[model samples]
Structure formats: structure tokens, C-alpha cells
Target: MKKFNWLLMVCLSVGFALKAQDNSMKKLREETAGKIKNAEKDTTGRLWKRGGNFGLMFNQGSLTNWAAGGDKLSLSLLATFNGFANYKKGRHNWDNNVDLAYGYVNTTSLGTRKSDDRIDMTSKYGYEIGKNWYLSGLFNLRTQFSEGYLYPSDTTREFVSKFFAPAYIILSPGIDFKPNDEFSLFMSPFTGRWVVVMDDTLSAKGSYGVDTGKHVKSEFGAYISATWNKEIMKNVTYKTKLELFSNYKHNPGNIDIFWTNIVAMKVNKWLSANVSLDMIYDDDVRVFENKETGVMGPRLQIKEVIGIGLTAKF
Candidate 1:
């Protein structure tokens, strides 16, 4: 009788232990599921994201008594701002971006002059029509913030460009291929581009391929653009964009090219190093050659900048 009672007691203990373990596992599963549900709710409910970065760059030099020749006093300052507003929900997407940069330099031999100037803005909206493809419309504008001058050694500064003197506006209805957030390609066979010369003097001079005395010139064209951005490594990022436009109304064989690339490296919380390059070629825009030969023709334009600067993100 006692042996039977002992065996029964052992069986009861095993059953109780198994039941306790099962309850513990069930409790853990419920907790994990609750956390997952909260995470999904938090992310799906958010609609808009906005962020930007600001940078200030400076260069200065002074020479009083130096073995090598140098300027007495030189200083330069550059300010840059880049920002974006992006919205995504369901099958709709909208993105807007702005970039503004301006810089000036001064030297003992030369007076203050503009080193760089640019203002670019783009807005695009898309509705999903197929896998990784969207029917889209885009608006883009590019111009300069201040006046520009030509500095020939023998003569005084001659006005070459002013704000809105050669502003560009592009509107296109296209198909956007966005495989991911880091890359995009857009194409439009029917595109309208406007070249606006707001300054009367520049308009009268037929600046930027516009007819003499014309304030605005319009062209129908085909447009293609691609953009890519990626983090090369920790704390380093690279971005590039390429744009092509062929005017069907004019020289459709001669295409316009605009390309830009930027590389940024973070040094710390408030300091960074950056390099930027821009290249442009437009067939209709003519540049003056040597006065002795008196030749004028279209030419490629390029700009490059490298600097270490104070940066802020918001």
C-alpha cells in the first residue's frame, strides 16, 4: 500500500511541474505579441517626415613677414542649407527638397567676389500604378541668389549674371521608377522647360539662349533624370544626380547635361568635411572667347568645392 502511495505522489509532482512550465510559456507569448502589436501601430500611423542640415564654412589667412609670398589678409565664408519634406501613406508619395548655397571670398590684391551661388528646388508626387513604378509629376527650378560678374585683369568687373537673369523651370509628367528609397529614375517624353530672364538688361542682350529683348523662352523637350544616395561607410555618405534634356523644337540631337555629386564625412557632432562638384553643358548658351580672335561659342562649365565646416542637423 505504501509503495503504491509513493508512486502516485511522484506522478502528481511531475504533472504539476509540467503544468507550471506550460503556463509560463503562454504568458511569455502573450507579452511578445503585445509588444509587436504596439510597434506596428506606432509606425503605420506616422505620415510625414522632415529634416534638414545647415553648414557654415570659413577660410582665412594673414601674412605680415613671410619667407614665401602670400596675401596680407584673406577671408571667405560659405553658407549652405539642405532640407526635405517627405510624405508616404498607403499608395501615395510626395517629396520636396530645397538646396541653397552661396559663398564669397576677399583677398589683398582682389576685392570681394562671389565664389559660388546656387538655388535649386524640386517637388514630385507619385501614385502607384504598377510594381515599383508610379505615375508622377515633377516641378523643378534652378537659379542663382545674387549677381555674378566677369573679372578680367585689364578691365573692371563686368556684369554677367544677376538673380533670375537665367532662371530655369521644368515641368514634366512622367513615370518614376523607385525601387527603393536610395535610388530613383524618371523619364518623360513630353516636357516643358522655360528659360526666364527677369533682368531687362540681360534679356536685351539675348542671354542664356533667349531671343534678344525676350523675357522668356519656352521649349518642348524630352527629359530624363536619375538620382542615387548611399552611405559608403560609417559616418560617410555620397549622393549624385544626373539630368538630360533634349529640345524637340530646336536641336534635338544636341542634348543638355547637368550633373552634380557630393560626398560628406562626419568628423564629430558639429564639424564635417564635404566635397561637391557640378558640371553643365548647354548647346545654345554661348561663351565669349579671346578678344583678339573675337570668337564666341558654347563651352562646358565646371565647379568644384572642398571644405571643412561647422554643421548642424535638425
Candidate 2:
């Protein structure tokens, strides 16, 4: 009887221990599964990828009783934002980008002046046709958000441009070559481009290649664009883009050119230095010289910007 009682006690202990271990494992599995489900929900089923950054730069100077000459008092501020949304699945891809920049300066002598201004947006969608090649459609818009003036002298300010007074819109169906994530080339044998001048004064002047007294100008053309982006070294990056357009209806032999380059040096997580260069050549756009003489012609337009600023990425 004693032997049988001891054997029964040992069997009961073992059974209880095994039951406790099984319950612990079941609880662990439930917690793990719950965490995974929450993560999936946070990402919204991994449908889209998004990222962007914002930058602000400031410069100021004040000259008091100092003998050294200066602009008396001056202040400048520049703000920039860039963002992108990209979608990729089995055989379809869509990419979208937005870039905005505006800058201004105020001086006791020069008054308030716009130093830089731009609003650019692009969208492209593609379906894979072969290795590293896709059939794609692209749309882009370029404009500004404020009025611009030409200051011939300290007291002379002439209205040169305004929001949508000279806007460019382009649409193309093309073939895109993307051999890697850092480089892309796009070519479209046929494209449509529109130049818009919304202001009555500007439209009446036939600004931005528009017809005389017309608000809009349309052109059919062949377009090509190439882009390159890469990290040159630790905390340093470079990017460049070039685009060409030839109007088949008007001047098929003359091609328009647009090129831009940028270099960035990251000082820390929140500080950076950047430089940018942009150049544009358009046959239809004319630069007026000696308006007193009524002389106008086309010329290359170039701009450059360099600054150190606070930057935030997300």
C-alpha cells in the first residue's frame, strides 16, 4: 500500500508540472501573435513608401557705428521641402515627388527682394516591359508661389512675374530605363507641353512663349530626361538631372535644355550644407534688353544657391 501511494504522488507532480509549462507556452504564443498583428496594422499592409525632409537657412547682419561699410541691415531666409511617394508591386511601379523652395532678403538699401522661388512636382507610372526597361507615362509641373520683380535700381521695381504667370506643364508617354536604384533615363518620341500665363498683364505681353495676347501656348515635342543620384562618401551625397526637348512643329532642329546639380554635406543629424546649380535654355523664351530700345532676345538662364542650414528628415 505504501509503495502504491508513493507512485501515485510522483505521477501527480509530473502531470501538474507539464500542465503549467503548456499554459506558459500558450500565453507566450498569444502575446507574440498580437504584437505582429499590431505591427502590420501600423504599416497599412505595406502598400506605400513615403519619406521627406525640411530645411531652413537664415542669415542676418547689422551695421551700427562701425566705419566698415555694409548693407546697413540685412536679413535673409530660405526654406526648402522635398518629399516622395513610391509604390511597387509585382510588375507595376508608380513614383511621385514634390519639391518646393522659397527665399527672400531684406536690406535697408535694397528693400525686400525674392532670392529664390520654385514649385515643382512630378509623377510617373510604369509597367515592366523587359529587363531594366518599362513603358511609362510621366507628368510634371513647374511654377512659383509668389510675385517676382526686376530691380533695375534701388528705387525702381518692375513687375516681372507672378504666380502662374509663367507656368510649365508637361505630359509624356515614354520608355524608361532603370538599371539600378540610383540612375534613370527616360525617352519620349512624342510629348505635349503647355505654357500658361494667368495674369492679364503678362498674357497681354505674350510672356513665356505664349501667343500674342494669349494666355496659353501648346507645343508637341520629343523629350528625353536622365537622372543620377548617389552617395559619394560618408555623409556626402550628389545628384544631377538633364532634360532635352525638341519641338517637332516649330524648330525640330533646335533643342531646349535644362540641367540641375546638387551636392549636400551632412554635418550632423540636424545640420547640413548644400549647393545647387541650375541652367535653362529655351528658344521661345526671350530676354528683353534695353526695353528703352525695344530689343528682346533669347539667352541662357543660370542660378546658383549655397547655404548651411538646419535640416530634418522623416
Candidate 3:
């Protein structure tokens, strides 16, 4: 009876221990489930939206004494990013956007050279005033990331621009018409624009409309901006912007123009292609050679880039 009592006691103890362990595990699981549920909840609120895309592209070529002479080894790489965040609550709305791109190419003979570089950003806040109309204030910036050079020949290059050598800043209080999610038009009677050439070399040369030996210039202008973004078809999207500015105190009839376009085509979940075109004209910036006239003066500048590569969206 003593032995039997000992065995019975030990079995009861084991059973209680097992039951305690199971209860502990069940509590832990419940806590984890609760945490996961809370994490899945939208903490940013329904009025806010955010998205972005990033791309990396590359090209490579090798020629081994073929009939057509070419570089023995050639490689190029390009990276790009575009992002936006928007908030709309009641009569108030705010929008922020950013764009960045850089590219370089290397060849057996030409060495390495910059092929593309850009930086653009914008922020706007608005309050609804009437149907499809809002009183808005906007801020914009444009600059470059690295040194730019003009290649007069395959063996010679002249430094033209660099980081902050030519930076543009614009601020305006405007009326915005936003009819839908895909289009926006903004107009301001008076806009403040600043052109900055921070580099000593570029400042002394009066680069980018800045006065010689001066670092900055201020101008008041009338500004008009229009933007459109939409998915035109399945897996293809188009985005564009057009800007017009006229200096009120200077040659008002000589309106400056800036236009940009981007087209993105989604090939699959991880592959993509893109094309971009940009044009700019400023009356005071006189350094480009006209293709037709072959003269260095104020000329329309156009740039285009096309690439196919890997992409990520978030």
C-alpha cells in the first residue's frame, strides 16, 4: 500500500505539471494572436496614402576584334527612384513628392563618364475653397548629384556643373484645380524663384543665370504648372508635367518653359521598362549650342533616357 501510494502521488504530480504547461502554452498563443491582430491594423489612418518605385538597370557589351570596330569592354548602370506621400482629410490636403536618378558608363577607350543625373522634389498644402478648387502653397527644388561635363571631343571635356553648382528653388501661393485623382493644375500670379550657384568656380563664371561673382539671384515671376498621372492601359502608366514662368520685373514676354514626361511599363512582378523625356528653357541661361545654327546661346535643352531593368514597388 505504501509503494502504491507513492506511485499514485508521482502520477498525479506529472499530470498536474503537464496541465500547467499546456495552459501556459495556450496563454502565450493567445497573446501572440492579439499582437499580430494589432499590428495588421492601419495605424496611418485611411486619409493618408504612400507608394514608391525603385529601379536598377545595367548594360554590358564586349567586342573581340569584330568587323565593326567597337569598345572591347563596355558597361553602364543606372538607378532611379520616385515616391510620393499624400494626405487628404476634410478640407485640408498635403502632398509631398521626390525623384532621383543617376547613371554612368564605362568603356575600354573612353574610361568612365557620367551619363545622367537629376534631383527633383515638391511639396504642397491646400485648403478647399470651392468646388474642385483649393488655395495652395507649393515648394519646389531641382539640382544635380554629381559633376557634369561637356565633351567637346572624345579626348577632351569641360566641367559644366556639379553638386549645388546650379540649384533652383521656387515657392508660390497658388490656386489649384484638382478634378480627380490623376490631374492637377496650379497657377500663381506671383512666385518667388531663386537661382543659386554655390560653387566658387561656377559662381565666378555666372553659370545658370547667376550674376558673375555672385552666388545667388532672386526673381519674382508668374507661374503655371500642370501635372497628369494615370495608367493608360494594362500595366502601362504615363506621367507628365508642364511648367511656365514669366519674370515680372524682366522680359515678361520671354516665358521660361519646363516640361517632363515619364512612361513606365511593367513586364512582370520583378521586371520593368521606362522612358523619360525632359525639356528646359531659360532666357538668362545662355550656354547651349544650337544644333541647327551651331551657335552658343540660349537654346532649348532636351534630354531623353530609356532603360529596361529590375524594379521594386512599395
Candidate 4:
């Protein structure tokens, strides 16, 4: 009888321990599920998110008695602003972006002159049609904020462009493939492009595809654009956009390309470094000269800029 009682006690203890362990596992599973659900809810709570960064950079130098040959009392200044507004809800998504930059430089030898100027804006609207695909429309505009000049000599300057003088507008109805938040591809078989040279002098010269004395030139084209924004590593972010267009009304074989890229690195709060690259090629816009031939013709244009200074994020 004693042996039987001892065996029964052992069996009861084992059953109690097993039951306790099963209850603990069930509780753990419930807590984990609750956390996951809350996280998802929090992520989808906001329908619109807007943010951007602005930067101001400058450099100054003074030389009273210097051995090397360089400018005295040189000063440079640049200001930049970039922002985006994005909205995502059930089946609709809209994105709007703007970028503006202007800069100037002055020296003892060279008078104050504009170093850089830019204005670009884009708006995209999409309605979900399939997995990772959407029916979309895009509107884009590009121009300059101030007058642009080309200098053949230190004393002689020629007018090149100004606000709305060589402006470009692109409107397209397209299909957008968005694999994720950071990448998108847009393609349109039928696109409309307008080139405007509002300035009388530039218009009279038939600049930027506008007919002589005409203020605007219209073209039908096929357009493709790819955009990507990514954080390649910690504290480093890169963004790029590539655009291609072939004018069906003009030379379908000669394609126009526009590409821009930006890389940003954060050193600390309110301090950062930025690198920007922009390239453009247009068959109708012929102003660049071939140094070897001394003939004016269409050529690839590239500009690269690097800056390090104060940054503000919003």
C-alpha cells in the first residue's frame, strides 16, 4: 500500500508540472500576438507623412600677403531646400515633391556671379490596379529661379536662361510599378511635353526647341522614368531619378535624357554632407560648343556639386 501511494504522488506531481508549463506557453503566445497586432495598427494609423531637409553652406577666404596666385576676399554662398508630401490609404496613393537651390560666388578679381540655380517639382497620383502595380498620372515641371549666363570672357557674358524662359513641362498617363516604398518605375506610351522660352531674345533664337519667335513648342513622346531612394548604410542615404523621352513628332531615334542623383551623409545633428550630380541631353537644344571643331551643337551636359555645412530637417 505504501509503494502504491508513493507512485500515485509522483504521477500527480508530474501532471501538475506539465499543466503549468502548457499554461505558460499559451500565455506567451497570446502576448506575442497582441504585440504584433498593435504594431500593425500603429504603422497604418497615419495616412500622410511629410518631411524634408534644408541646407545652407558658405565659404570665405581672405589673402593679404600670399605667395600663391589666387583670388583675395573670395566668398561663396549656397542655399537649398527639398521636401516631399506623401499619402497612402487603402487603394490610393499620392506623392508630391519640390526641390529648389540657388547659389552665388564673389571674389576680388571676379565680380559676384551666380554659381547654381534650379527649380523642380513633381506630382504623381496612383490608383491600385494589381499587385505592386497602379494606374497613374504624373506632372512634372523644371525651370530656373533666376537668370543664367554663359561667360566667354571674364568681362563678356551672354544670356542663357531665366525663370520661365527655358521652362519644361511634362504630363503623362502611365502605369507605375512600385515594388516598395523606396522604388518606382513609370512608363507611358503617350506623353505630352511642352518647351517654353518666354524671353523674347531666346524665343527669337529658336532656343530649346521653340520655333523662331515662338514662346512654346509642343511635342508628343514616349516617356520612361525610374526613381529610387534608399538608405545604403547607417547615416547615409542616396536618391536618384532617371528620365528618358523619345519625341515621336521629331527625331524618334534621338532620345532625350535627364538624370539627377543626390547622396547625403549625416555627421551629427544639424551637420551633414551632400553630393549632387545632374546630367541632361536634348537634341533640339544646341548651344554647347565642341572645343575641337568650334561648332555649336547638342552635347551632354553634366554638373557635380559637393557641399558640407548646416542642415535642418523637418
Q: lDDT for model 4, please.
A: 0.93
| Per-prediction TM-score | 0.84, 0.85, 0.86, 0.85
List candidate 1 stretches off by more than 4 Å.
1-45, 290-294
Score each candidate by Cα lDDT: 0.91, 0.88, 0.92, 0.93
List model 3 lDDT by residue over 7-123, tens digit each. 999999999999999999999999999988776665455678999999998989999868889899999999999999999988998989999999999999999999889999999
Better of 1 and 2 by TM-score: 2
In model 2, what lDDT does residue 171 have?
99
**What does candidate 4 score on TM?**
0.85
What residue pairs clash in candidate 3, if any at all? Answer: none
Could you tell me how far off, in angstroms, the CA of residue 139 lies in candidate 2 after the best superposition? 0.5
lDDT of 1 by residue, 116-207 (tens): 89999999999999988999999999999999988767348888787888899999999999999899999999999999999999888998
Who is ahead in TM-score, 1 or 3? 3
* Per-structure clash totals for the candidates: 0, 0, 0, 0
For each of the candidates, the C-alpha root-mean-square deviation to the true structure, in angstroms, is 8.9, 4.7, 4.5, 10.4
Clashes of 3: 0
Query: Per TM-score, what order, best first?
Result: 3, 2, 4, 1
Candidate 2 residue lDDT tens string, 51-87: 9978898888899887878888999999989898988
Which parts of model 4 are misplaced by more than 4 Å? 1-45
User: If both were scored by lDDT, which would come out higher, candidate 3 or candidate 4?
Assistant: 4
